[model samples]
Target chain A: MALNRKVGFFKGLKYKGGGPMWAWILHRLSGLAMVFFVGSHIIAGFLTQQFGSDVGIAINIVYENWIFQLVLFFLVIFHAVNGLRVTLLDLWPALLEYQRESIWLEWLVIIPLYVLILFTVLKSALGL
Target chain B: MQKITLKLFRYNPETDTKPHYDTFELEAEPTDRVLDLMEKVKGYHDGSLSFRRSCAHGVCGSCAMRINGQNMLACKTLVQDLKTSRITVEPILGLSVLKDMIVDMDPFFDSYKKVMPFFVNDEPKPAQERHQSIEDRERFDDTTKCILCGACTTSCPSFWSNDEYIGPAAIVNAHRFIFDSRDKGAAERLQILNDQFGVYRCRTIFNCTVACPREIQITQAIGEVKKAIATGSLD
Candidate 1:
């Protein structure tokens, strides 16, 4: 198209905000968190294997911690299920018609799973 | 008469390096349309101000602009609808702005044209009128209301990022034909929309649906198109 002015670089991007946008943004953040967790995990594994007693104890401490286990569980579940949602979107673009309901459904499924994990971690943490 | 604040975007590409907002205090009734306020500004307040309007009603879709950060037909939005005395108006995004509130629409229209938005029939023309059932015509009735207003497309973030994506307006027009029972070009149109740069580019953000002046459910239509692409079924 003919132009009287170039589209504003900093300001032109303003658009209405909605569910899919937030879902995509959250997915990226969750992926980044997983990347960090995985990176530290690999390093811990390598250190534990080579350093023997000292690093092995440290790795076990973190591995057995209930708080650490809970967070790890939450992040993995969120990333995996949300990733599946993304895949469904890519393969069948029409799924967007139900995007709102799908998002609510994702929460419905994730929340019970979260609570179940919560109890499992508690049982192990307290040794009850 | 009550005084209302009109914060209009002002930019002159010829002279000004930085675009800024120009606020006009005017006498207006709470029921006056936003376009009415603008007309008053241009008619008596300052003749140098420029914006496009025809029909002075919502039918032409010429007065669409961003009011309070939402794209809507200026004629359709009432002063009281804003619920505030201060109003902020600017040109729609996803298109190059020419001046004050006018935007370069060639890119928008070109995307619509690329969809090949017309009926096609391979068989010889019927000597008599081609007949259609009410059900067949009802399938695409929602899309026929589109007036080529840039509201839906311009409000889309993907369209803002990539003008080549064949925004929602084009897709809506394509839906009008693709679902028409008498049209023989559904395959061709579907092929065009199935391209990586086509319908799949829509992120289903629903901004287009919200911004459409005709109240057309734009995202829903786009989803229907996507279903047709995936299942090989238009139902």
Candidate 2:
């Protein structure tokens, strides 16, 4: 009862949770990233209103950076696809046996779409 | 016989301030079970080595421990299965270790008890028996294989973060009764599992499914429980 010690994050990482564990971790990380992005976006909008066009332009520069855009796009796409995978499996328990395949399917869907996004972002960043 | 190095976790509440590993070089057949290696070390090398073993055949689930980074029944895992001469054995994670390779199972069992693991049917008894169809029997057959080894629960990251989560084993047990046609406690069990600390804590990580020595489809079972709670339909 009193002896319960929380497993350290790195120690828990050592335990082989396999593909699903990675998926769970990614899903959580992406979800958090999206929340932070939205919160910062709202704050940026407020700053733009109070601090004038200079602050708005500075914030736009960071947001418009291709590297940040690529990472943000990845977080959004992965979170959506993985959330769909988890939701689909939760809705249909019989599909649970194909969980590994579902994870594969999620990657299959994410890769092509992410690649296209990467190409578009890279072209714009390079002025190509 | 092949040369193997057995690394065991050592700890004593009375003496050692922290746990440490003790290594023993011993020769054993590749076919020998990990439990056999532990026995040899305890019987010959050091009598101070401590671990739990009962039945020595994986039936009682007493010998469940982390073998080569995976939760497995030592009696059921062979030396050859490890594909290496070096073996590292430790207690399953999440619960507090009472000694070396032996954790306090009371916390694990407390979660099990919270799920109402026993059959509860307040309906009047039938003349001979409460008849169940073969189809109905198969509904909960997978979850019935749980030996309460604490492998699945301890392997869960959710449980490692918070012991109050009730982990996956309790959800599996809840699924067993939730789907039972003969049991009238489905509604009660569903209500119990509907909490945030209940079924929702499971992140669909599949660690419980992998850690289960019985090869139960633990994640599928938990999914079923979640569905039952959401729909309020045991079907």
Candidate 3:
């Protein structure tokens, strides 16, 4: 049988679930955000170092902005901590039986780090 | 006995352009199954309504559907377990529905066959039966409980998004033979499973594990296969 497009990408979200599905969705989105952010950051660095300064200047203005930095901070921390939880679960499949427990643990690890990063970025951004 | 309103999904692709739910009011004992509820509606209320069941004891895997927003064996789920005045019955997701409640399972079986779900032993026959250690049997024992029910596969998130991803059930079926000490078919099966649409496509959503009627630790089985293939170790 062919693919049923009626069951679209948000099929999982359509169902009420515990923490794992939401964690998976967030992990994917955060990972994607990191990929775009790093790709641009690397591209901007190379451009500034080699070609004209126009691309670099534009990227620097965005990078120096506190909102951009805070977004980057959120994305990086979320991706890393969730990635660690996923990796640990992968390495030990037995841990997956505790999917609910691990998700809370991932959040516990993520939130405090996220808050600390947020405050630091806020301090730096506000210049206070 | 209690009066329950069963809101069931109704669709005939040949006649209707879209799927819709048909509600049936029926009397049922608290101990009666969801399948029994459907039977009351079909026998007394309507005949054109469609569904499938055989053993009615849950072994046949024929009556698997979403009952009360969960993938479960209709015959295996009692009315009281749902605890709702209105029982919402729907076909399993990510599969084409053929009629009122039955889903087309041909594509689901196609993926099962892709795993070469039989023993492949080209070796010379021994005088005795093929031997397997207790430990080796224990390794893949969890996967052997699969009844070929589409519950786990239909419930998989990867199968929902990408229909070609070989789903969790097939991977679990493959895991049955991959770790069998007597079987010499791991390499060939691993090739198909290692494809881009293979086992790697599973994002560990764990829906299959939750939906499985046999209570197979499906995600763990999938992980064991992935770990085995990557390290070239069959432990």
Candidate 4:
């Protein structure tokens, strides 16, 4: 893919410093997002299981949509990567000095991982 | 018994272009306090030297200044125990320097006042002093030991970022009243500290614990505040 202005912008956001202050801010943001999204996900799943065949129609209406799938995909990826970062920092005080570097690296790693996951989702969605 | 060298930061807002360090060589005794050395430097070496001290003891907590880059009570630190040929002293960090070894304490006290560091009891005080069980009183005893010293506050990194954090010293004081069974304003005080800049800002660095001259467990008090908030039991 050609590197466009949009890609450059996303890269800039991804590479921003993850110092202790930044880590704390991101940790809170990711945690809140995880709590809200995962809570809704569990509720929807439980409703689907309870309603059985009628719920398959509701599930198809929701899951067949690309926008909702993409949002959910990004949410899961963000929560996973940021959650791991928070866990590492909490467990290892010695890694504090390299927090900024590690944050940039996390974005570098997560972007590719998310891209692969997104590719898989699109393949399955289009039946390609 | 040995001669010691003191490197003291000197700045006079009224006259000096910028702050500078002045080194003084002095003969020291085993039991001599850091305050004693400062007094000697002011009276004999340079009469214009300025710093705050009262009671010549640790109780007043006014003599808190940076000794060898660490916040400590000048009156309580013994010269002989330092075991160093050279020592450096400066005013407390994260405060406006008023002059050499003197800082503006209004900001620190302002945080204390914001927390409303006073008792508010709905129950009328008994004609005899309000009686309390030893366990209940002990909860606040450590916090009450704070003598308004800037040591703990200055040592905290969170206070450096947010001047409004009510620092360790002030928060400990507020906790003293908040945890008291007789106090009625616990919820109000907790509300003031529940903001992004308040107790949540504390990263539990424990610098305040090491800096306290009275050996007050400042971090523990902050932890208790966290517990109170988490349990929704500030009342």
Residue A89, candidate 1: C-alpha displacement in angstroms: 7.8
RMSD of 1: 4.3
What digit string (tens of lDDT, one per residue) describes model 2 on residues B140-215? Answer: 9999898888899999998998889988888888888888888888888888888879999988889999889999
Predicted model with the maximum DockQ: 2
The residue pairs in collision within model 2 are none
Report the Cα lDDT for residue B164, model 4: 68
Clash-forming residue pairs, model 3: none
The TM-score of candidate 2 is 0.92
Worst 10 residues of 2 chain B by lDDT: B226-235
Question: lDDT scores for all predictions?
Answer: 0.82, 0.89, 0.84, 0.76
TM-score of chain B of 1: 0.97
Model 1 stretches astray by more than 4 angstroms: A1-14, A18-24, A31-128
Model 4 spans with C-alpha error above 4 angstroms: A1-128
Q: What TM-score does the predicted chain A of each candidate obtain versus native chain A?
A: 0.75, 0.90, 0.83, 0.60
DockQ of all predictions against the true structure, Cα-based: 0.30, 0.55, 0.33, 0.02
Question: What C-alpha RMSD separates each model from the true structure?
Answer: 4.3, 2.2, 3.5, 14.2
Which pairs clash in model 1?
A: none
Error of 2 at B102 (Å): 0.8
